[model samples]
Target chain A: MKRDLALLLGILLALLAALLLWALHATLALEPGPRLAELASARLEQTGVSNPVTAVLLNYRAYDTLLELAVLLAALLGIWSLGPAPAGYQRSGPALAALVDWIVPLAILAGGYMLWVGGHAPGGAFQAGALLGAAGVILRLSGEPSAGLPGEPAQRWLVVLGAGVFALVGGGLLASGFGFLTYPPGQAKWLILLIESAATVAIGVTLTAAYVGGRPGSGTAHNGTGQSRTVQR
Target chain B: MADLLILPVLVPLLGGLLATALPVRSALVGTLAALATSLSGLSITLLVWLHGDLGTVLGGWGVPLGIGLSADGLSAALLAMASLVALAISIYAGSYFAGSAQARHFWPLWLLLWSALNGVFLAADLFNLYVMLELLGLSAAALGALTGKREAIAANLRYLLVGLLGSLTYLLGVALLYTAYGTLDIGLLGERLGPTPIAATALALMVSGLALKTALFPLHFWLPPAHANAPAPVSAALSALVVKASFYLILRLWTELFAPITDIGAATLLGLLGAGAVLWGSWRALRAQRLKLLAAYSTVAQIGYLFLFFPLLASLPPGTARDDLFAACVLMALTHGFAKAGFFLAAGLVQQKAGHDRISELGGVAQRMPATTFSIALAGSALVGLPPSGSFIGKWVLMRGAFETGQWWWLPVTVLGTLLAAAYVFRVLSRAFGLEPTPLQFVTNARTEIPALLLAFASVALLGLAAGPVWAVLGFGAAPA
Candidate 1:
């Protein structure tokens, strides 16, 4: 009965989607102009960055980006709450370990480059952070426990660095009567860079910690018992 | 003053980050943050009460380009309710998670969730609302799963997935709106919106997505387990505040942004779903074996009552009648926010004292904890719309609206739902009155007990008796004659 109900609901959902698509097709035929894009480009000079995307992301709607960082932090904190990380794999053979050693440093260098080029080009903190995160994952697969993350105390600070710095900057701006996240004239570029740099480190650390899949270190021994209780249930 | 609107969202966010960094001092940081957030929120409400409305574009960019934050009568009223209820929950949590391993995890995530709730209330940009919703969903699900129970984990995992889907669907609708209108600001879109098919489709999509998150009837399957299994304070926030945030958005969209596109048919469909929810949820609460589960189911029923206003609101002409009905709707939501939080907190205490919350076995513990029992009873009265409770006023107005519009069918549903609510509330209260030795003291565990008692009192006395201020906050001047 449940399976049949699911199938019926699926069909109904498909019909709804089709109807929505038809409506959208008729609406788009009216040809809404690229007004927002033009506006962003027109105002790009006022923003610190040359990239229109960054202009909107960091200056125009910076509040959204700040909250997005908080969302990332929330996700990482959620992962940490589950329990301690599972044991790492046995030490990798020398050849794979050597490969990981070479790849990790190179990935870090590339990540730095990506972060630098984001001001004028396509790469930004997120892409750079992903590379850094990949480097940490490689280290973990090579049998480094903690996934190349520092101890729990340092890990906490690193994870919050992005959102913490972003919020502090915004708050400081607000206090200075510039409004929240509103950069001062001629300082928008440097401010965006500083915020992006902090976000990159935080995102990279958060992603690596999330890859570890649980809380780090010896402080969370209580959750071990809680995990066993779940098993018993 | 307009710039102060961002403080409510910012203060808690900074606190969450600080709490995340300083695990040992997390509780202290969380408490301070909660206090600051509530004060900032209430101040915004005060400012709105003094001034008509306030709006600001972040980064000094004009609307349609930059994100904006705004506070009007509707947002201010909900903001004030959320502030008080959250402050109470934070106090209750300070005791509930005291010295536990979950304290560090709970503080940061709870603060983050509070920040998102504020963000949702103040946001004037559609995409910004989506971001706030995602943050709210993520933190809420994480907090709900804090118990580490198998059922809690499973239920919250489902909740997280469902939330993501809802946000994505809502985002799709937003993308369509941007495509059609070239703006994401609520005020700008409202000005530009016409009765176009795209606008209609976007409204449908957005409302449907928000309905899932709000747990409107058929989409509420995940809510009961997720809410029932969470640690009590988390459950209180989930049931009381988080669901209402999404419903607030739907109300804003329907009456403010999508008014030209909205019609009686869609509103009636929503009302019918609400009727289904009222019956199904209240019936389930009556059948629930556990105290927490009963409270969770009651939330589903309470949300149904809020939606019942939509059909009436759609049909009512712009006059004092419509204005009064809207105030009553906001009153019902605020009362439920306080009442449900109180109910869940008291239920948690009962569960703690008894080591289980099984309703059938609660009589002894319920008798032992007099303060807790009283809290439950007060909250239950509000839930059942008893005399001199805020929901009584809400129901009176709801029924009046129904009669005024000649939609008399809703009156029967309203009546039946109320009867069911009374039955379930009395059933629980009856457990408290069982023949066990009465506690010598009326108050115990002042830290926790007082918060629950105060919340319930607010629902019954503050809201029920002095609801005139609710209209004043909503800019409706005085209470309806």
Candidate 2:
């Protein structure tokens, strides 16, 4: 019965894919009228960022990005609520530790570079944050507990930093009679950089905490049963 | 005035962040934030009431390039209902999870979910709605699993996965629409959309996705366990607000955005599924062993009733009759929002007192906690479409619509669902009247009991006795003419 069900589902999925492709083809075949691309490029300079993607993310559609950060924080909080982190792996060998010693610093430096170049280039907060998070993961694999993250209290503040700063800036703007998230004239670049910097730190911390897979603590307060369920990755 | 539109979403968001950072003071911050958020939402509703409609593009960027927030009559009516229900839930939660580790986690996630709910009601961009939906889904699922029990965890995990799939499907439809029309703004898309095959396909995909999330029959398998196994406060939010958010989306899409392409045949198909849900869900609720489970199944039936209006709406010509039908649909939704939240809150108190919510075992709870029992009775009456309940008016309109539209086949479904609803509600009430030592006062633990009682009273008295406001808020002229 299970096999039959699976086969039926597979067939249905195939049909759906075919239908979706056809629909996409029909949709794209229409006159690709004036889209946001033209409008975004036309008003690019006013956004204070050369990169249109950054302009959209940080300036025009910043509300969505702010909520996306909240989504990230919510996910990490969900993980933490399950319980504290399990025991870390065994200590790494001298060679592995040495490799981490070199790679971690280089990753951090690259992350900073990415954050800086994000104004006019491909790298940005999310990418830079991912690099920093990778470094944390490497540190964890080398047997560092907590993924080298701070204590619980500081970790809490770090996870919310991105969304908090973004909201604060927006609210400040609104209070000053500018629309929410509306950067002041001649100040959009600096504001975007500030928001992006905070976001990078927040994203990095959130990703690392996620990799740790649970709350960062000694596990004394939480229920004892959670330990058995915690997978040691 | 339009600039104030963002506060409903902003206040709760900042509150969530604050609550996360200051875990020790989360409850206080969360409660204050809930108050502020409700005020902002209610004020927005009031503004829309006084001033027709309000719209604002964020960051001063114009539409088709920037996201817009708009509050129309439809959104404002729902927003008013959501604000009141959410504030009551927040109060109930302050007591429900008091002095537990869960309280710290619950407040932050709960506030985040509130922000998303507000975002959904006001968002003018389809993609922004998608983002809001994701945030709502994630926080709701997480909040549902706060109990840490195996069943709760398993059920919520399934819910999370299902919600993600639904959002992805919806996003695909959004992408399709954006690709075709080159805009994500709902207003712009509505103006540009035609009766094209791609438009139909996009509608199908989007409605299907939303239906899955809304737990529209046949696709409602994941809702029962997920809702029933959740902590009570979470269960109330899930049943009352979360499901309604998705249904609200479907209603907007069906009646406004997709109206140009939507045919009566498709609307009838939805009504048929709704009929199935009404019967199936009510039958299941009638047989449910536990109170929360019964409430969950009843939510399924209630949602079914909401969809039953689609066909009637499609068949009606554009005029006061159609407008009245639309207002009735919104009234039914608002009534359910209050009734279900009240039912779940009261049930939560009963469960806490008794250590279990098995319907057969709840005998003396009514006598001991008269206020809570009364809440349940009142909320259950609204569910059963009793006299003077908002749903009573809702059903009256529904049956009348059925007759006028010649969709008389739906009459039997409505009557049978109402009968089953009464049977289930009375089954619990019967348990409540059993011999036991009665308390002297009506309310015990005013913090918890009052919110439930007020919500139940709102559904029965406030909404039913004075439904003119609902019509007025919907801009259908006072008293439905």
Please report the candidate that would top TM-score against the real structure. Answer: 2
lDDT per residue (tens digit) for residues A51-165 in model 1:
7777888899889999999999999999988887776766788899899989999999999999989989998889999999999888888888767888888999999999988
- Badly placed stretches (over 4 Å) of model 2 are A218-233, B437-443
Worst 10-residue lDDT window for candidate 1 chain B reads B435-444
Per-residue alpha-carbon lDDT of candidate 1 for residues B325-366, written as tens digits (9 for 90 to 100): 999999999999999999999999998888999988877788
TM-score of each: 0.97, 0.98
TM-score of chain B, candidate 2?
0.99
**What DockQ does every candidate get?**
0.77, 0.83
User: What TM-score between 0 and 1 does chain B of candidate 1 receive?
Assistant: 0.99
lDDT, residue A47, candidate 1: 95
Q: Return the lDDT, model 2, position A138.
A: 94
- TM-score of structure candidate 1: 0.97
Please, what are the lDDT tens digits per residue for candidate 2 over residues B247-346?
9999999999999999999999999999999999999999999999999999999999999999999999998888888999999999999999999999
